[model samples]
Target: LFVAGPILLVELYPARVEFAFYRMSLCTKLGGLCETDCLTFKEKTGSCRADLTPLCCRKGKKH
Candidate 1:
């Protein structure tokens, strides 16, 4: 018999709202998955940042 392991829960958001502050409010209720010690999602904003880009996880790197 095969057993399943813990599943990774990923949340999907609309392109228009992914990095919006309003949507971030809802994330707080979800325990803020980005609080992990590993890599995390950060809102990329401003001229220096890429618009609507989702940060990718990297190995051997501390968030």
Candidate 2:
């Protein structure tokens, strides 16, 4: 007979959007380009995404 004391299980979610946001990688994936500084940009027309590295500069004007 075999006996087990305890077991731990962990599950990873790859389809989740929340987990998809990784550094600046998500920027281009979201149709936005990554920039060093948004203020230094020529256009300065787009906005930045939350908690993104190198600044995820989104295209189009703000509403």
Candidate 3:
């Protein structure tokens, strides 16, 4: 049931929409970290950046 449930859920959504949803969800969770010194420093000074992290401001948009 657990395995099938996830597979079925993934199949239910279009690939692009599903990937966007996942990215948005991840961004929301990571957005809270923006207040931390590391993220804040990079945001303000534009240095010491982490390439993998998405900007909190870019929450959503049409592709």
Tens digits of lDDT, candidate 2, 1-63:
123322211123333334435544666667767665654433333333434434666655546
lDDT of 3 by residue, 1-63 (tens): 989999988887676566655655665565533222433233322211233443333223235
Q: Best candidate, lDDT-wise? A: 2
lDDT digits (tens) for residues 4-59 of candidate 1: 22222223334434545544444444334222233434432222112342222223
Question: Cα lDDT of model 1 overall?
Answer: 0.34
Give lDDT per model, in order.
0.34, 0.48, 0.45
Clashing pairs in 3: none
* Preferred candidate (TM-score higher): 1 or 3: 3
lDDT of 3 at 19: 61
Off by over 4 Å in 2: 1-21, 39-53, 61-63
Give the Å shift of residue 53 in candidate 1.
9.0
lDDT of candidate 1 at residue 12, scale 0 to 100: 38
Find the candidate with the highest TM-score and give its number.
2
